[model samples]
Target: MPNSSANQVSVIALTQIGAALARKIQGQLPISQLVLPEKYAVDGEQSFGRCQFKATCQMLFKTSDVVICIMATGIVVRTIAPIIKDKTVDPAVLVIDERANHVISLLSGHVGGANAWTNRIAKLVKADPVITTATDTEHVQALDTLAQRFDGWYPDFKYATKLINGRLAAGDRVNIYIDSDFRGIVTDLTGFTEINEVADDRFDVPLVIISDKTGYPKRQNSIQVIPRVNVLGVGCRKGIPYDAMQAAFVAFCQQHGLTWRSFYQVGSITKKQHENAIHYLAATLNIPVKFYSADNLQTVADHYSQSAFVKKTVGVGNVANTAAELASGSRTFTDRFATDEVTLAASRKKLKVDDS
Candidate 1:
């Protein structure tokens, strides 16, 4: 296994047969932990007593990336119904019979990757994989899957996705617009027409637009996928407030015509490694951030605009632009914003679509 779930899994076994089956699965998937009642738990299993099963399941439902329950579909459904919020945020939920005859993708089929995990678990247990998602059943590449494949951010519009995917499954025309810079290598082109620009006259068909730019406004039946190709370099005064940093970044995005989802990573000099505000900002945006040593940032400092005060304080004249350039590993470019407490710069990772 490639550890897609960060090695966090919960296999709920309600009975002896389920426990045996869970053990079989756990043997192959070392990342998965067996969750069973205390009576059924043998050793090295998460044992819950009498009335604790439901609570345990609820807790694991929130924490685990995948929850595979060896129980009736109805039981799993009722147990998780209260906590199920949305497909985007929920964990992959799978249901299997005590005998492991069928592995069903019960919830979060596409975005949470339950469908894929269902197939994997079925293969491991030699069970039939039951996936009911239209895209999977109809043999059409899903819009969300397409976004995920290319590291693009799933658009916030779920209704648009439902309508577009419905049309795609029904063999209707769906236009896909890939911005020149945002179009990475897509392996499939079935059930879609590639268009340079969405025509103003076409309103009957659905449109799928992939880009980091904010040029395409949301239409009646359209989904916009933001490519996570932007790298952010940030610098801030000591103990800068999180709200101020966030406001500055939001302003930067507005000025650049980019969505917050366009950024995949954040970078700053190592001196600000303990900066709580920067870390909070990155966490709020659900983006990973890294810190580079001042020496590493210095190598690229001269390529960008410098500040004497910054050099005197941190031994580097330009933290934001230099950090962005270094993190992106590209030739110098110039896009920066300076605020009273924060300086921010953005660099786009070289687009594969731009390749000749």
Candidate 2:
């Protein structure tokens, strides 16, 4: 499959033949745009002249979702060496020969999706795809790739992943505990034993837990996969500062042993849809904000604590709790807190496989 997660693709070619090959690759990827030197660029195509290739690459590395350098692997390597970041944050980087004979997954093979894009482009142009990730070659799924498949994320502890993938590569059946909600989503369970609980006895073996909750007792060989399933609900006074709202939200999570990473979106009543503080909090969290009308929230308001003042003002007795329950389609709230100025609540959306 083409890398659907990659919204923007930058194809860089320095030579005439490479430019022509890049054009063919770009034809298959409609989201891709060509970047060629002035001498090789066609009309209306992005072009860079003498001493500009390095700067152009640096820009694309930061802005593009996928960077395909159709030139010598070494040149691309040296150019990106200074700007290379962790695979968790870096864009996928691919190297293709001028003749399009091979598409090499040079960097960020798993987490950044280089391997997937390389395979896609190679298939498009009938080229050999060179993917060297050990798990891929050994026909075992890596922890990072597995998380990506389920729209989840692993911790930044690389040692845990390396140990787990190494065990899988050695043909070991790792014990995995996928939350009941996510268990039905995965189609394959070839080399894994699904465990009901994570006990101390399993620490000796490589263990993997996939859940949206926090506080999983894990050893060095354990991999915790956090899916974006939590939905946040907010209620703040008029013109509440962003700092106050954020402080209260963080406090709420900390008190409930929750982490912000698992939150996918924020919910609020339509009466507070124009509230700047809620919008700012959502932006800082890098998640979208969803607004529901007071009438919608009223259906679930009775199940939660209510305030007469709020009901008189916004036509709903509760905002944070009701909004979370309504937006997540959950029958109840997961966590909630209330203060004179701000109120916060959380809910878990119903989990199911989203093939789209």
Candidate 3:
């Protein structure tokens, strides 16, 4: 097993090349994601379910700090490009062509903290990690990296420093979730006071603080950091002719009988021109608009019921499902996000979210 570190990483891909590469990378690194085949996604193993690729990517993007692209063509590019097109949360994006000959560092190489990840993954694979991030290339101070140091890292939070210059500074009451067997989590620097048993949900803890103990459960709820269910995905035209995208999103949530407070973010395709709707929705709710590039979104893939209209409107099927999956880790069939209309899945089963 990989000895996990401060943060978690998830890989998204279905192709033989992608799956093989993901396994190779996970062996050396601790932070990782689930590697699923194209089947067992949408409609079971009956049809090749790349149909919902965009939704799948969105779900994975929500759960990941970085995304590694392994496909070279088709909905992969079309699904991933729109995510990073506008100013956004910028997950670490690295690409390895299907041929496995070269790796390309596309976006957020520094802040997404993929540089160190590359160094670790490159050694496992033959090809070098192609990093284009200026700060990584120049070896400058990264605010995100500085905050994640775990030792006296009291201050750290940002959106896109180079692009839109957005910031989400850290504050008090930051919940830090770790595994039950996490012996080294609680320390003098960490301020965690309790570790309660929650339902079989909750993996989307955005803000985290180090816990100050050592008797973490080997099979407890804290194993999966910020594990949660019911992540809401929002989308609209880039420059959606609206002043309150958050309000609209909230209305949608309310209309659907969703617990408004349960939602952690408002997300969409990364196009500023069409982002007014999503940004408005997020700003109105004072939540973050976690954006991902199309390529970044493709890795996890989606399992939505795709239609011709959906293809024309969303352009891909994998993102929403992908984001939901990421928002709740790889466990997509959580209470609120189940494929069926019924909302209860784990509570009745008495399962826990972080059970290892």
Kindly list the per-residue Cα lDDT of model 3 for residues 77-178, writing each as its tens digit.
567676664323657666666566766766566556667666655656777767655544544433344334422212212322321111112222223443
lDDT of residue 100 for candidate 3: 65
Task: Flag the better candidate by lDDT, 2 or 3.
Answer: 2
Off by over 4 Å in 1: 1-7, 150-156, 197-203, 236-257, 270-312, 325-343, 348-356
How does each model score on TM-score?
Answer: 0.76, 0.77, 0.36
Query: In model 3, which runs have C-alpha deviations exceeding 4 angstroms?
Result: 1-7, 27-31, 39-48, 73-77, 84-88, 140-144, 147-356
Give one digit per residue, the lDDT tens place, for model 2 in 87-187. Answer: 87899999999988999999999988999899989989899999998888987667877787667867665876787878888888799888766777766
lDDT of 3 at 242: 52
Local distance difference test, each candidate: 0.83, 0.83, 0.45
**How high is the lDDT of residue 254 in model 1?**
81
Error of 2 at 305 (Å): 11
lDDT of candidate 1 over 263-356, digit per residue (tens) = 8889999999999999998898898999998899998887887989899999899899888888888743437798999999988777544222
Instruction: Find the 10 residues in a row with the least total lDDT in model 1.
Output: 1-10
